[model samples]
Target: MNDTDNEITTDESESTDSEAIAALTVRVVGPAGEPIEGAIVRGEGDGVEFGGETDADGTYVEEEADTSTYTIEVDHGEYEAATVEYTHDDDGEVTVELASPVAVAELSVRVVDSAGEPIAGASVDAEGRPHDAGIPLEFSGETDSEGVYRDTVYENAYAITVDHEEYHPETVEYGHDGDGGPTVSLEPIEGGVPGASRITVAVVDESGSPIEGAEVIGRGTPHEADIPLQFRGETNSNGRHPDVVYHNDYRIQADHPDYTGEIVRHTHDGPADVAVELESGPERIPVAITAIHPDTGGAIEGAAVRLVRTSGPDSVTADAETGSDGAALLEVEAGEYNVLVADDIDLTLVETEYTVAVGDDPVQTSFEAVTEPDDCVLTVEVVDGETGSPIEGARVQADVRAENIDDMGLAAGEADGNGIAEIQGWCGEWEPAIGSEGYWPADPGRLDVAGNDALTVELEPRE
Candidate 1:
C-alpha cells in the first residue's frame, strides 16, 4: 500500500506541472496590416518565461508557456515598442500592431513684459498627447537670453505653463505645427519692487467741472534694461484715475469727446499727483478772409484784418494782412468774434465791423472796398392832413441813386414826438415814403438831397 501511494503522489505532481505550462503564440504586424519579421516578443509572469522572435509570417509560437496572466512586450528596430497586459489560457493567441517611429517637431515659446520686451530665465513646462491615440509628448526648460524656450516634440497640441519670480504665472494652450511658435506675455506684479510708487490723475474742464469717461494713458520712460512701462485706464465718476508706477518720469494724456485733448508730463520721485485741464469746446481752427473790390468785384490785396474774441475766454488778438491773392488766414479759438478790416486805400464799406461765430471748421468770408461817397442829411416832417396835427411814430424810408456810386436804399428813422425824421448818408436823388400808425400812407415824390435839407409831408387820418 505504501509503495502504491508514493507512485500516485509522484504522478499527481507531474500532472500539475504539465498543466502549469502552456503553448503561447504571438503575431506581429505593421501598421498597414502587413506581417512584421524579426520582431522580438517577450512574456513574463505567472511562472511563464518565454522569449522569441517573429518569423517571416509575423508569427512567434511558444509551445511551452504557463497558462496564466502575463505582461507582453514587443520591440522592433524600425518601430516603437508596444506593451500590453494579456492573459494566456490554453494555447492563447495575441496580435500586436507596431507603428513606425514618428519624427519630432520643433516648438518654441517666448515671454514678454507689458512693453513687449522679452523676459529671460522663466520656467516653462509643455506636455500633450495626440488628439487621437498615439505616444505622449513632453518638454521642460527655461528661457534663454532672448526670452526664447525651444524644444523638439511630437506634432501635437500641448498646454504650456510659465512662471517667474517677479511676475505672475500664466498658462496657455499651444499647437505644434510647421509654422512659427507661439508667444506668451506675462504681467508684472504690482508693488513687487522695493521703491515702487503710485500716481493719481485728475481731469477737469475749463470751468473746473469734472470730466468723466475720459481715457487716461500713462507711458513711462524706458529704463536701462529698455523694458517699457505703460498703463491705460478710464476716469471714474469723480474724474479721478489712479495707477501704480516706478520712480521715473511719465507722460499722461487725457481725452474726451466733449473737451479738447490735453497732455501733461510728470516726474515720479514719490507719491505724486497730476492735474490735466481740458478746454470745453471744439479745437482752434484757421479762419480765411478775402478782401474784394466793391466796384469791380475783384480781390483786393494789402488789407489788414483783426479778430477779437467777444464771447469766449480772453485770448490774444489775432492779426493778419492780406497777401497778393487777397487771402489772409488767422488762428482763432471757437467763439463769437468781432472782425475788423482796414486798408491804406479808401475803405467805404457800408459796415466796417462784422460779427461771426467761429467753430471747428475753416471759415471763409469776403470784405469789399469801394470809393467813399459824399455824405448828405435830409429832414422830413409828417402831420395829419385832415386835422392839421403832428403825427407821431411814423416810419420814413429813402431810396437814393447817384452816378459813380452804388445805389443805396434803406429805412431812415421813425418820427419823433415833434413829427420829424432825419436821414443821413444820402448823396443823390431822394425818394421819400412816409407812413404813421393808424393813418394813410404819404409819398413826397422825389427830391434832390444834394441841394435840399428839409421837406414836409402829410398823412391823412383813417376814417
Candidate 2:
C-alpha cells in the first residue's frame, strides 16, 4: 500500500491478506443540488488511473478499488472545476458541487431623468447566458425608490431595457468588464419649447366677451443657444392669437382701445394657454396727442410719447409711439400727468403737465418740435487701440439717463466707411458703448450731448 494520500495500492501480489473494497461512487452536482450531466471525473493513485463520464443522474461508480485514499478532480463545461479528497472505506458516496463563475460577482444598474433626478418604479429587464451551451440567465424587476437595481448575472455582456410612464423608453448594452455599473438617463415626454414649443393667448372683457384686435406682447429672460422668448401680434376675430413657438417664464401684456390694459405673468413648461381680462369704465380715460415740426409746420412721424402720473396714490407710467400720421393714443386713469415727448430727428425733448378730471371728453393736444436736425447729434469715431487705424462697421448705442424712463435703450447707429457713427435724437446726459466683430467691447462711459458732439473710442483685438 502507498503511504501518500493520493496513492492507492493496486498490486494483486500484496493484496492476498487484505480484502478488496467495494466500488467508490462520485456524484457531481450544481451549487443548488441539481444534477450536472456529462461531467468528467478522474482519479489517479499507485500507478493506476481511473476516469469516466457522469451519467444522467450525475453518478460515477468505480467497480474495483483498494482501501486507499484518492484525489478526484471534477470538470464541467459550464462551471468552475472542483477537486475532492476521498478515502474509500467502501461505504458512503462523495458529492462534488460545482459553482458558476458569475455567482461570485455582482451587478448594479441605475435609472434617472435628464435633470439627474432618480426615477422610481421603473421596469428593468436583462437577458444573457453563461456560455454557448450553458443555461440562459435573466433578471426582471422594478427599481427601488432610490432608482437602483442590483443582481448577479452569469454573462459578461447583457442587454438591458428600462421603461417608465412619464419618460421615454431606453435600451442599452452593458458589459461586466469594467469597474462601475451602468446608469441610464431618460428624456421627459413634455420637454420644453424645443420639444413641444407652442403658446396660446386669449383676450376677453369683464363679462367674458371676446375682445378682437387686442395687441399681445410677451418677453422673457435671455439664455444662450435657446430661442429668445419675445413675440408680438394682434388677436384674431375670435379673440385668440396665433400660437407663439416659445417656452419660458414671461410677462405678457394685452391692450385694446375701448378697454383697460392688462398684464399677466405665466410660465410654459411645454405648451401653455393663457387668458387675459380687460376692464372698461369711465375711470379709464383715452388721451390723443400729435407731433408737428415748428419750422416746416408739418406732422412729425415716429416720436415716442410717455405719460407719467404726477397726482395719484401709486406712481404709474405709460408709454406709446406716434404712427405715420404723427398721432398716438393712451388709455389711462383720470389724474394729473407729466407728458414727456422723447427727442427724435429735428425734435427736442418736450415736457408738460396736464390734468384729466373725472367724466371728461377724449383730450386732444399737439407737441411742437424745438430743435434743428443737427442740434443734438453725437458723432463717434472708432479706431484700433494698438494700430490707431479707423475701424469700419462698428456699432454704437446710447441710452438715456433720465430718472423717469424705465427703459434706457434709445437707438443705435453703425459706423460708415470713414469709421464715424452719428447718433441723433438724444438729449441731456447719456451712456454710450461700442462693439465690433473681431475686437473686444469698449469700456462704457458718460456722453452728454449738451457738452460734446464728437468723441473717439478705441477697441482692442482678442488674443
Candidate 3:
C-alpha cells in the first residue's frame, strides 16, 4: 500500500510541474488597432519568472512553466499600465489593450502660517522631475479655508510654490509615483508684506458725514512694491488725515476694522478728498486723452495736455504726457474741460483750440492747425523696363509755361536716378512728359498740381 501511494503522489507532482511550464504569447494593440512595439511584458507565477519585450509587430512569447495564474504587466510611455490574469496553457495567446496614462498628477496641498493656522486662497504650484522631463505639464489650485488645495499632476518630479498676502512666497520639491493621496505642506512666510502701496485719501459716511477712525489701505500694484503699507492711518473724527505716500495708481480700501473693507480707485490728480457715504460703497470713473500732429498728419509723442473743469472755484485739472503713440490719459470728474496741448514745432498756437467733456468714462479729441495755401511742387521718376534700371539724364518736361521752358518747347530737365525734379514756384494747372531712346513720346498732360506741398508721379512703361 505504501508503494502505491508514493506512485500516485509522483504522478500528481509531475502534472503540476507540466501545468506550470506552459508558455504564453502576448500581443499589444493601441487604441487605434495599431501594433505598439518596445512594450515590456512581465509575468510571474509560483516562484517562477518569465518576461520578454514586444517585437516590431508588438508580439512577445515567454517560455516558462509557472502556470498558477500568471499576472502580465505592460508599460508604454504616456500610456496607463495594462494587467491581465490567466492560467497558462500550451500555445495560449493574450492581447493587451493599453489606455493612455493620465498626464496630470492628482495631488492635495495645504498651506499654513507659522502659527499652524490654515491660510485660505493661497496659490499652490507643483513642479518636479516629470515636470522637468520636457513633457507638457501645468499645475494650478487655490487653498481652501482649511488651507488645503487639490490638484492633478502628470507622473514626474516638481517644485511647488505658495503665496498669500502679508506673507513671503514658499516653495518646495516633490516626487510622485503616479498614485494619488499625497498631501503637500507649505510654510507661510511671516511678517513680510506680500504687496502694499499708499495714496492720500479722504473719506465721509453715508449721510455726507465725515467718519473718523476709518482705516485706509491701498491695493493692487502699489501693494506689490518694495515699501508696502499695511496700514496708513485712521481717519480723524472729521474724516481727514495727513499721510505721505508713494506715487502709483492704486485701488483705495477703507475699513473701520468693525465693518467690511470698501474698495475704490483714485485716478484723479492731486490730493483726494472725496466724500464716501456708508450706504453707497465706491464709484469708478474711466480716464483717457488723445494727441495729434497736424504737420505730418501723424500723432505727436511726449506732448503734455491738461483738462481744466469749468465749474465754480472748485475746479479740478488732470494732466498727462503724450506716449509714443501720441496719446495721453487723465482721470477726472464728469464735467467740461478747457483742453490745452503744449505747442510744438508742428503745432501752431492756434492748434491748441481743443476741448473735451470728461464724462464718467474716457474722452478723445484731436488737434490740428490750419495753414495758408502755398505753391505745390511735382516730382516725377522714370525707370527702364528692360534692364530694370533708372533712365538717368533723360529729359522730363511739363506743358505748363514757366519763365524758363527748355529748348524742346517743353519745360524739360535731365532725370536723376533719384528721379527728383522740382517744379518750383509752380501754381495752377500743368502737364508732364519724358524723353528716352526706344520709348514712346511721354505725355506731359498726366501731371496735376492742386494745392501746396509735394506731389509724387511714377511714369508707366511705354510699349
Candidate 4:
C-alpha cells in the first residue's frame, strides 16, 4: 500500500511503490437542490487536463488525475461562476453549490379617473425611491401609452402622487404587498355652470309646499370667484330646481307673484339638495332690484342685497337675494336706508342710498356687479409623516385674493374620511395653513397654481 503523502493507489497498480493516478467526481447543484446541467466542470494542475460540462444529473467524472493539487472550476451563464482547489489522491466525489444571480426589485403605478377610465397625460410622482429627490416629482412621467408607469425602485416605503388638470389628485403611501404596485383612482373635477355641472335648489312655502313656476336664481358666493351661475328654465311642477351649477355656494332667491320671496344661502359643493322657505305675508310691495352684467346683459342671479338703516327709528335691517329675473321683493315699512349691494362672491357693487315710501307699486332699483372671470381651483390632503398614513379631521384653510373676481377671506374645511379637503380653490398665488392635534402645525406657505393644482400637507407629530 502506497501511503505516501498525496498519493492514490489505483486498481490497475497493486504495488504500493508505484505512483497511483487518482480520479475525481464533481456534482453541481443549484440553490433548490436541482441539477445544473450546463455548468462547466474543469480539473487542472493535476497533470490531468480534463474539462467537461455537467450532465442531466449534474455529475462530471475525471477518469485519470495524478497525485497533485487540482483547481476545479465551474462556469455557468445562469449562476455565479465558482472554482475550488484541492489535492486529488483517490477517486473522490465533491458537491458544488451554485447560486442564482441577485435580482433587483421593481414597482409599478397605474392611474385612472373616478369613472374607472384611464387618464392620459397625468403626471406621476414618487418619493423615497432610489432615484434622486424631485426626480419623479419634477418629471416622473405624464402617464405612458398604457396610462401606467413601471420601473425598478428602492425596496422601502414609498409615496405616490398623481395630478391632472381636470381631476382631483390621488396621493398615498405605498408598500409592496406582493401585488407589485397600486392602482390609484382620481376624482374628476365635477360640475360647473348651469349646463356644465349639477346643482339642485328646492323652493318651498312656509308650509313646505313646493312652489311651482317660482323663478330660481343663483350666483357664486365669496368662496368662489365671480363665476356666473346661469339657469334657464323655471322650477317644474315639483318646485325643484335641479340645474347644472358649479362646485360653489350661492345665495338662492325663490319668488312667486302671489307669495313673498325668500332669500337663502346654499352650498352646491356636492350632490346635497338645498332647501329655501318663502315666508308669506299679508301686505307688501315688490322692492325690485335688477342685478346685471353691464357688458353681457346677463342678469346676475346671486347678488347679495343688504338694506342698512342710514337714518330711521331703532334700525330697519332686511336682507334679500335677487331672483332669476334679477329682482328681489320684501315687505318693509317706509324708511330711509343705505342699500349696500355686492355679489355673493364679493364682486364690486355700488352702495346706493335711497328712501322707501309705503306704496303698492313696486319700487324698482338697479345695481351693477362687475367682475373678471376666474375658474381656478385646488384640492388638498393631509397625512402623517412618520407612518405615511392619512390623518382625518385636519383643518385646512386657503386664502383667496383675486381682484376683479372675488376675495374669499379664508375658506376653511375639515379633512374627510380619506383625509381630503376641498376648499373654494384659488388660482394664482395663495397662502395655506394646516393643523391637527398632537401634530406640529405646518407653517403657512405660498402655493402657486401654475404647477401644483393639488398639494399634500404632511404633519409631523410632536415628539
Candidate 5:
C-alpha cells in the first residue's frame, strides 16, 4: 500500500515538473460583441508560435506561448485589424477590444440659378489640391433633375466648384462635421456678356413720339486719336431702345442729317432721349476748273465749267470751267466743297478742300489737283488672353484721314469665334486699331496704303 501511494505521488510530481510552458487564450469579436468567424489571429512574443483562425465562436486559444508580452492581431474582411498586447498569465485569458471600421460619408450638393431656381445638368466638382491635382480620392458628381448630387467620399476637407452654361461658376470649401454631412449650395452664373451694363434710349420724333429706325451711338473715351463707339440697334416702333451698352459715359449724338442734329449728355442708366427737328436747306452745287498747256502751266479759256457734288455716291457734275491763266474757277453753293481741277489737254487735276460757313457767298475757287485712288485695305482680329483663344464679340475700329472729309466713320462689326474681323468701306491712308477687354491697345498712329488689298493685325493680349 505504501509503495502504490509513493508511485502515485511520484507521477503527480513528474507531471508538475516536466514543463511549465505559458499558454494564452485569445478571443476575436466585432464591435457588437458578436463572435466573428473566419478571423485570422496571429500572436507575436518570445517563444510564441504564430498560427490562428477564429472558430464559430470567434475564439482562438494560443498554447505553449512564452510567459512574456504577446501581441495578438485579429483581422476580418473590411473590418480593421484588432491588436491586443498582454503578458501571458500561465493559465488565464486576455481580452482585447477591436474597433470596427468607419463607414464612408456621403455628400449631397445642390446648384441653383441666380433666380433661385434649381439648375439641372450642371457639373459639380471638388476644386482644390488633391482633387484638382487628379487624385483619385477626390470626389465629383453631376446634378440631377432635383438639382441634387450625391457622392460617397472618405471623411476629409474639400473645395468645390459648380459650373453651368448660362450662369457664372461658384466655388466654396467644405468639411465634414462628423454628423452625416451638410448640403452644399452653388450660385448661378450671370448673363453671357460679361460686365454688360443696360442702357435705355428714348427715340422721339418732333412730336415726342418714339421714332423707329433711329440709331443710337455710344462712343467710348478717345485713345490715341480714336474713340471707340458702340452702336445700339435702331429704335423699335414703340420708340424705346433698351440696349446693353458698355459701361461708359458717352457723347451721345443723334442725327437724321435732313433733321437738326441733337447732342445730349447720356450715361448707361435709364432711358435718355433728345429732341431733333428737320429743316430743308438749299441744294449744294459743285465747281470745277481746268489747266491749260502741257509746259506753260497756264489756264486755257473755254475749258468748260464742270461742277460736281461730293456728298453721296453719285457724282453730280453740272458746270465746267476753262482756264483763265493757269487755272480755271467755277461757282457753287457754300457749305463744304471738294473742287476738282481738270483739263482737256493732259487731264492733270487735283482736289481742293474748302468749308463755306453761313453768310459765305457762292464763290470761285481754283486748284491744281491730282487724282489718286486708294489701294490698300486693313483687316484686324481681337482675342481674349485668359484663354489663348479668340473673342467672338469684340468690336474693331479704323480711323481714316481723307482730305476735306468731316467725321468719315464706318460701321462697327462683331468678331467671329475665331476672332477674325473685316471692314469693307475704308479708303485712303488710315490707322487701324483693335480693342477688347483682356487685351492690350493695338499699336496706334498710321498704316501706310501701299497697294496691298488687305492688312492683317494681331491685337496684343491684355495683362
Candidate 6:
C-alpha cells in the first residue's frame, strides 16, 4: 500500500478457512498519515458492488467478496477522495492516502514566569499588523491551569503580549514562523520603581468654607535659572486636588466663579502645607460717559471708547459705542481706570489715557476728540429754500462712511447766524446732506468728496 511504508500484516480475524469469498479490509489515511475516521468508502467492480464507511480506526471490511479487481474509493470532508484497485483473492489489506487541499497557519502560546513554572490567570494576545489602516486582525486567549493559549490565524506579522497583575509584562513578535508555536516568558517584579508623590492642596473661601470645582494651578518655582512652572488641575467634590510634583518650592493658585482668586508660595521639603483665603470680588457700578468734539464742542457719535481698570481685585475692561446722542454706558468697578478712545476715520482723537474714579452716580463725564492734521473738514449750511436766507439755530447733520474701518461717524451741529455748520477730518466716502429741525435734504445727490480738501453742502426748509 502506498500509504503504509511497512508491509500490510493480516490479522487472524480476517482469515477464512472454508472455500468461500473472503473479506477485504480497506483503511484510509490522511495527507499527514493520520487515520481519517468516519470517511465514506465504496468498492465497485464488474458484477461486484459494496459500499461502507471507515470506522474509528479508519478501516472498513467487506465480507463474502469475490476474488476480483475492485475499485476502492475513500472520501473525507477534510481531504480529497482517493481511489485504488485491489485484487481480493484471499483476505486482503489496503490503505489509501488522500491529499490535502489548502494549508493554513496556526499559532499556540505558552506563558510562564522566570522560574519556568506555568502561571495561571495570565492574558495572552495575538494581533495581526495589516499593510494599511484597514482594521487589524486580533485574537485573544487566556491561559488555563497548564498556562497554554492557542488560536488559528492567517499568514501575517503578529504581535504578542503576556500580562499578569503581579508580573512584569512580556511583549514580543510571535508570527511568520513555519508552523511552530512560540512561547513567552514573563518575569515577576519584586517591587516597582519608586514614583513621585503628590502635592495635596485644599482651596477655601473667606468664610472658611470649601469651594468645590475650583480651578487649581501648581507651578514649580524658586529655580536658580529662568525656567517657568507649568501645571494645571481642578478640585474635586472636597475642594482638594493632589498633583505629582517634585519636592521644591512651588506657587499654588486657586480660583472659582463669583469669588476672587488667590496666589500663595510655599516650600516643599517633605509634605507641603499650602492654604489660601481669597477676599471678596469688587462691587461694580454702572456709569455712562459722553464723547464731545474738541473743536466743535458737540457730541461726536460712533466714537470707540473703552474703560480699563487701573488697580482692583482683577483688571477689567468695558467697551461702549456712542449712540446718535453721543452717549455710552460703562459698567465700572469701584476702582480707578483710564478711559481710552481710538482714532478712526470719523474723528482723529488721540489715544487719551484720561483717568477717572468710578463712584456711585459718578455722573456723566465727557471726552473731547483731539483732531489730527489729515482730518476731513465737512461743512453743512441750513437755510430756507424760498427766502434763500440763513437758517440760524437749525440742527445740521453729516454722516461719513470709510472703508477698512469698523465704525462710521456722524457729526451733528446747529447752523450759525450765517447758516454755516462745520466738521473736520472724516476719511473716505461720505453722504454730506444738510438736515435741520424742520428742513429736508431737498437736494439731489450728496457732494462727491472723494479727494476734496473742503466739502460744503446746503439745506432747504420743507414746505
Q: Each prediction's TM-score against the native?
A: 0.29, 0.30, 0.28, 0.23, 0.23, 0.31
Task: Show model 3 residue runs off by greater than 4 Å.
Answer: 1-102, 110-139, 142-148, 156-159, 163-168, 173-177, 180-379, 383-463
Tens-digit lDDT string for candidate 6 (73-126): 888876788889787788878889876553335566788888889888788876
- Tens-digit lDDT track for model 4 on 113-134? 7777887777888765464321
Q: Across residues 39-119, which tens digit of lDDT does each residue of candidate 1 receive? A: 999889866578889998999999977767889899988788898888876877899988766545667799898888999
Could you list the CA RMSD of all candidates, in the order they appear? 33.4, 27.5, 20.2, 29.0, 30.6, 26.4
Write one digit per residue (lDDT tens) for candidate 3, span 1-463. 9999999999999887666455678898764344778888888767767787899898898765555777888987746679998777566888998764434445677677777788889877665554333333456678998888875445566677777754667777766555453444444344454322324466776667777888876553543423543336678877865554544455667776334467777553345554444444323245555565556777777876766778646677777777887777765667767776653422223234456666555556675422222355666666664555676766766755322221112345667766555554344446676667666556645444664434334444566
State which candidate has the highest lDDT.
Answer: 1
lDDT of 2 by residue, 145-209 (tens): 99988765444677888877667778898876544579999887664324336787899999888
**Where does model 1 exceed 4 Å of error?**
1-194, 226-228, 283-463
List residue ranges in candidate 2 displaced over 4 A. 1-181, 185-283, 294-297, 343-359, 369-463
Model 6 ranges with Cα > 4 A deviation:
1-104, 132-136, 177-180, 192-202, 215-463
Better of 5 and 6 by lDDT: 6
Ranking by lDDT: 1, 2, 4, 6, 3, 5
lDDT-better candidate, 2 vs 4: 2
lDDT, candidate 1, at 25: 85
Question: The CA-based lDDT of model 5 is what?
Answer: 0.57
Among residues 3 or more apart in sequence or in different chains, the pairs in candidate 2 whose N, CA or C atoms overlap within 3 Å are none
